[model samples]
Target: MCSFGLKAALLGGVFGLAALPAAAQQTKVTSQGITPTEIVLGTHQDLSGPIKSWGVPVTNGMKLAVEEINAAGGINGRKLKLIVEDVGYDPKRAVLASQKLVEKDKIFAMVGPLGSPTVLAAQDILLEAGVPQLFPVTSAEFTYKMDPKNPQERLKFNNVPPYTDSVRAGARHLIQEKGLKKPCVLYQDDEFGKNVLDGFTQALADTKLTAAATTSYKRGASDFSSQVAKLKSDGCDFVVLGTVVRETVGVMAEGKKLGFSPVYFGSTATNVVEVPALGKELTEGFYAVGGMEIPYRDTAKGKAKEWAETYFKTYNMEPNTQSALGYNDIMTFAHYAKLAGKDLTGQKFLAAMESGDVFQDMFGSPPVKFSPTQHLSATVFLLQQIKDGRWVVLKRDLTN
Candidate 1:
């Protein structure tokens, strides 16, 4: 889980579901109804908070998928009923929002809940409710560790590969393929940063290469001149960053000012629209790995392309990969929900997801697949670099 400050954000209002015996069934508001009229599903997102940049567009993408599905005669003659609540990227807000969705809205499943911290806060709630949270937006490790023996009792039905996987792939490419002997890391001092560092360290276990220096920063800090100066003095040739847009640009600019430009690498969160637009030259040649596919209108396929084209034509703005990721997540859930058919229970929904079928969606390079044991799908990531004015894929697909 590479979320920056989601845990502390849940201080006041966050509430865990009441602990009950394993045999206890979640109180369903109404009887199971999967007919020709409606199939209700719920989601939580950050519409107005630190991560709104990723949340708003993703919600739009989910809406688009629901609209398209409804238009195409619905799923098994039943229209999808989606209920979304704003979590504001706060774990407390996420808990409250999810509670409303589960207790009041009576949704069958949950989709997004963007931040890793937020998703973690709702884990017990969803599990206690016996509702399958399909394709949560965050990649936190605890989000997928469902070993009951381990007292922590984390769930493992996440859709995307863990953030550790992305970091491992990128770090291997940097050390083995790119041959950077003196690598450093500019990481936010949080769970997200630690996750990336764990992967990077694990990848460099056999090799002699070590992180020459490590710098930690807060999320909203504006200046990084001293940190970059320290990196320059450390003689680090490459730096892997674990931060978001504002901080990422600030550090790179500081590096340039200190006359110490290294091959900058970062987490998937760097794929923000403001980076290239505002940072300009500072963002060039920076690399990151992401679960989303490139947003080229021409190369897209089937309903995916059609959705992109229609979105562009209607809004007159280019959609980023986040939209596609959101679209794919919701669509994939709907596909399984449809496959679940009349027996619309949480176990049935989970079974449908783990049916060992590779589904081609508008999200990642490789299609998504699940097995009885494997809960995570879409293991492949695309390594992209900012070239010219846009992000171009450096490699087609790097399966972790």
Candidate 2:
């Protein structure tokens, strides 16, 4: 195993990238994590922090997938090993976790690392080491945007619907149908929140309107009174939320207490089951953007329904959107890895992922189409609303 710090210092580079050697950089994607009978993979998620609502269940789903695959003889007859590190949604810790995974664990690929800032901070290390960053939980634009001049970027692929596109589609639809003008935005002060802000701004631009007000809160904050009060005071008839499950519930519940009734919208991250489950009456009629259907066991059908029930039986907990997505992410990885054939390498996996294949999940998500030049899985978005504690699709095939 190569030391991550030593690799950076060897070339006096920053983030192990600034001064990479030409020959080594050209052949970075080798079969590092492959063994005669096993293939090791890695991921980082916020298991103990604010976003654990997402991390815990997502990891549960991944574990379930690994079990399923291993029992079926694994991918190409080699069992899969997933090493998870809890980053607590902290970027610095994310980097250190990435170092440990890449250098010490010698993971072949980094799959489903959580958070926008954390993935951003740690991705260069994975890329520098020639390990592919696949299906990261974040939908930040940089995750899928390949730099034409950098071949290393070709290893990056994202399966999640982007925040910018999802919010833009939902916001635009609401503005057109409801004729809402006094738009306000309450966002977390971070990379994820900024994308939401940008999307809402673009939507307003399309409808020839401007924001009535915008406020931000720090990540992991439990109090949203001030931000809610600010938007309420601005007379916002519609508000865009840049929040995850907890913050989403917190802001909306706070708004209800303050009698701030308006159309509330959120990006894909808020489209999970927790939003409706936690907020209940407070979040009724809340709108959100996403590409995957929230897998409610009672309402899910076909393979999706079966999977949800099996998940509950195995884990003794109800399955959510993140759970379905995490399971799907691993299955998708296996599909491509299998296509990479028995001789698996980072280069082969990259080619397999970019082989113009369309992957569909059991949970009725938008079809994931990956091509040689296109890394983003889905571009179209869906608008859904929480009605009677369940998400109902309001519109489909929405675009920016």
Candidate 3:
């Protein structure tokens, strides 16, 4: 009887030893940027550059989100902190800023870093360090596309629909629904512009249509005379703008000057209040594709209205589409952070996001979903037109 009992005890000990590896595998792994009391994230923006029009408001939106989250007892008892640096819309400065954030500040992840060139410049360094690049502002396709040759490229995620997809939707609408032909494109000579051009080209191909003309301009060029003149000469009935706020205005203003009043359609880059404010009456009748509904102060309802009111109270200014975008991205991050559990790591945070959860922002538009292969959330867009110095919803959610 004593021998049998000892054998049983030995068997139980063996079973417990055999379970160790599995338990270890289930244990959470942690790394830098997470402390007992906080999680640190970083971003670089064009604080004093040509795009400061967007950078300042986006940063302000992020700050407000962080403030609200921290005030409400933080995320799982760990407060959130963001470290922002200015890259002045320069890729070299972006690299330097990212190096400081990763090597010196030791940020766990980068959230809402502005500009396609800036993100492309710094992505490799951050990904190599096993840091997640989360929700960069630009909709450049490379920001989220996984390289077939390298599976290690899974650390980057984009919250906005790719410029390709946004343009495709708009192009389909213009060609099929509006029955307009003679499409032309005016794009910047960079990744951001390239993505939009790709989308426009693809859409034309898909619909058995062809471009009347395509023109490119250097980044930060205030004058778009030659490009606009080319589109005018091409007799394009509709012009797709691969431009941001100022550039969009510049191109359209140039077109207006030339009496070239083609129906202008722009990607999400031009979907900002500043466009209308800067371009004034000239921006009127322009169309843009956006992933989320713009919360117009006069017509916003329910949660959007409340958010706008609070934002106005907090920032003492009106919130635009960019502001809402910045706010939504941070809030989405917070949501995934909660799902990542208390022992949060960059990998865990990413896993939480890729777990196929549907996320709906303050606006009652479509939900954003992510998976291993799909990183860009908010795949659909609503077509909006500027009327009476404001964006008026022209069409509901559109997908290509």
Candidate 4:
């Protein structure tokens, strides 16, 4: 469902047990990952690769959740066992890693696997084996947008705000609020980039505006002089980006070098703390839309402050946006797993997820809800900007 090169980055309640098929139940009832002592879940991350920036912190977050869950006497007496593999953000490695997880580790579910290409490459293995894929890191469309004809699609669920939805909200808000006349997009020529491009196009169409120009760069290219120059020459008043951490900073830096600054905007992925830290002054005023609020210790209050303190004390490093997500992903999974109770099977777990229960995180993200038909979570996104080398919220609850 996604076109990719290198990337970074539930059932239930309403339908009840009757909605689950006998074949699926038969395949999962044995629950390979569930033992008398523990429940095994697997994840693949880019520990030794490019996006390890995301993978390492996320893994740390998952560990925190598992530690907390297990400390509470584990989930219904079954301690959580998370076996993580280093996929290096490579699709081939991801497939191999997944095979090991399924065949050897015997993971009942795949949680927070990183990278779009990697997840896509490895997903079929898990699905065919009847292992549930929960909350893989990439926010690409296919992670949750399933074909109704395919029953196995329900086995895949996503929590991160999709790239398309966040971009749409950000683009529309910029055009109207900033009075942008000529909008354009400089996207990465890959799955993640294409999703941003689609969102940009859709946003322009919604505003009854047309794109001034659109250009793309290769997946890992650093020099965006040509793309930036093209957008500048086209007189684009605003430019939507389909870029992650490094590329986001690269594009803006190039624009600064050329003295051609427009209203720069990107998806939730660009709303990361890394951009500001890396880009320094070049990234100031850069805007992006995000679902999760960045929780800084000084600014955070109550549970958020408490969580940050706990995270730092545990990891001996400060938490960033990715850390929060990683922690939330496993916590969210654990929440449903707990609801699944002692006789946790694939169907019961799926049911618990779709039971329309509201999940709220300490980071002040939108409450997540899943249903039999709706798997994608988080409709609201916050529009943020970089000011003085830190991300500041500009607007909240941006929705189409």
Candidate 5:
């Protein structure tokens, strides 16, 4: 009987030993880019390219957020570190930069990567590695859409209103409120342009109206003579621009040269301080649909005034809408990261984000929220016009 009892005890001990690894596996944290004292994040931007004007301020804004957060003790005691790469606004270069960030740097996530084409080129690589692409600067709808068959596509989340929705809001305002008919479109032949065109077309369809003329241009083309001529010839009284800052200015200037003075509408891409600064007199009376509140320094009050003041003191430059966006993106990420707790993981952060909790930004615009199905944070936008050399808020919370 003693011998039998000894054998049974030995068998029980062996079973317990076998279960140890399974228990450890169940509790082991599966997060990357996290150290006991630091969490590493990275992004690629157009630091030396055509859009550097937009990229520089955005990078600065993100850095400012990192500084403020780290100074305030960071998220759950882990300091945040941001690594930025210059991609020159090129897709191939963006892909290469993303590979380095993922493979060499081993970043936890990507925040505020600029341009739709660049993001599209690098998205698959990051998604395949299960890294969260958080709050990319582009508002392309694909940034937030999830594919049920491919769960990896769910890794991307966007804080800005999609380009489609922004265009739709602008179109609705122009057609219904402003009494503008004879609409025309000048769009780039790319995903960004296509999304804007789609929204404009959908909005017109909803109103049973048709665009008078539509023209496309190659991306990064400087001269807008032909496209502007086509719209002018079509007698387009209201033109929707699917162009970025430079293109927006170029097209409007070309129109001005030809003495065509139709009302111009642009997506959030054109709603930057550079538009007025670079375009000068030509940008006057231009209207745009923006996902966030216009960061007008002179008219700012309350939280926005304080934010602008702090931003100016920190960066030695006035803040624009892009700056506001960058600051909001990092703050939003940190908020969710904090909610994920001290034992943070990418999956936990994602779950916290998908919990549909509303986040208040520094500018006191509308609260942002996300969910499993709805990954885009802001669906509504405000319409603003460049009046007297500054962006003036014309309408708030315009939606289609």
Candidate 6:
């Protein structure tokens, strides 16, 4: 077998199926904790391509988490070994990458593989392999949505909260908390946008509040003048958005040009780098609810402190929401892989994860809760807004 370095040697054994001899076990085993030295896992990201907007930082976050775990003597003394492939948010590439990770890398679990379409592509393979997929980066409902057409879809598990969940919370806060009544809706016309709208509707269902006007844009659209005009004509008091960074800025720019200076509310994606940078003045009142904490806060402690220090120390960049979330996904799974202990098959690790023993040890959000029937974690989210080119927490679920 190929040498797995000093960390592997310290753990004293190789991962293999129960039937294999120790010498040959390393050659064939695909499960984690089956060996003392290493736990193999897989992930897909947009490391070197167009989607690197999120892929680069997210990948770095996962790397930092894995490195930190290994330095801390690993889970049960077994170092995590991640095999990452970049899919650039392309669905076909994601599917291909996922297949290779399962068939060739022999990973015991999966993490990341960002973007809604990419995750949607890789979903079946992960489920069929029975490998635990922890904390994917997308908020698409289908990431953990119950299959309406096929009852079996409920078996899917993910650590990400529903996109709708955040949207609902944001909408409610916009109405009840922020006192924005006649809100307009702007969204990209796709699965992610639809989910956000669905949540917004559900939040105002009881109060009979609805969008003053709604306009849709394609995912990569660079212009939002027409949409902004509609909202302006409708006299919207606020505008809720279901868009990625590019469109978020575009809408804000057009709204500004059209003299529609309404407070902005958006999906958690608004907390990313572009929103505040491109729409500085307009993004001031922009609110988003998501998993990650506001970085550089004094109260940052425990996992948050660790992540903040290590992330900056290692990479020299502040970890963003996507980055923190990506890191959490991998480390939490590694925690479960260790808990499974020396027999880390898919079944064993999945069972361990389902036990919900490890809380969200990362710097953001509350601890997680998982089970056979529930794989999503951090059901609650913190509300944040941009102030002076940075994100700050505005409100948090008191339960955490």
Worst 10 residues of 6 by lDDT: 9-18
Candidate achieving higher TM-score, 1 or 5: 5
lDDT of 2 by residue, 182-297 (tens): 99999889999999999999999888998999899998899999888999889999999999998999988898899889999999889988888898899999999888778888
Candidate 6 lDDT tens digits, 1-400: 1234322422322222232333322222235324568878788998765457788888888888888788898877678888889887678999999989887777776777687778888888866665555677888867665444443343355666577887787677668766777877888787778888887778778447877887788766787888888899999987788888767877888877877788788777667856787677767767777766755634577767776777777887866667777787776776666655565565455445555454556565677766544557657777788887778787787221
* lDDT tens digits by residue: candidate 1, 53-157: 778878888888899899998876778888889888778888998888878887777776687778878877876666666677777676665553432232246
lDDT of each: 0.71, 0.85, 0.83, 0.84, 0.84, 0.70
Worst 10-residue stretch by lDDT in candidate 5? Answer: 21-30
**Of 1 and 2, the candidate ranking higher by TM-score:** 2
TM-score of model 5 vs. true structure: 0.91
Largest TM-score belongs to which candidate? 4
> Which one wins on lDDT?
2
TM-scores, all models, native as reference: 0.85, 0.92, 0.90, 0.93, 0.91, 0.84
Per-candidate Cα RMSD to the true structure, in Å, reads 8.7, 7.3, 8.0, 6.5, 9.5, 7.5
Residue 37 lDDT in candidate 4: 86
Deviation from truth (RMSD, Å), model 5: 9.5
lDDT of 6: 0.70
lDDT of 3 at 342: 76
Superposed by TM-score, candidate 4 places the C-alpha of residue 26 at a distance from the truth, in angstroms, of: 9.5
Extract clashing residue pairs from model 1.
Answer: 1-140, 2-192
**Model 4, position 13: C-alpha lDDT score:** 66
Supply the global lDDT for candidate 1: 0.71
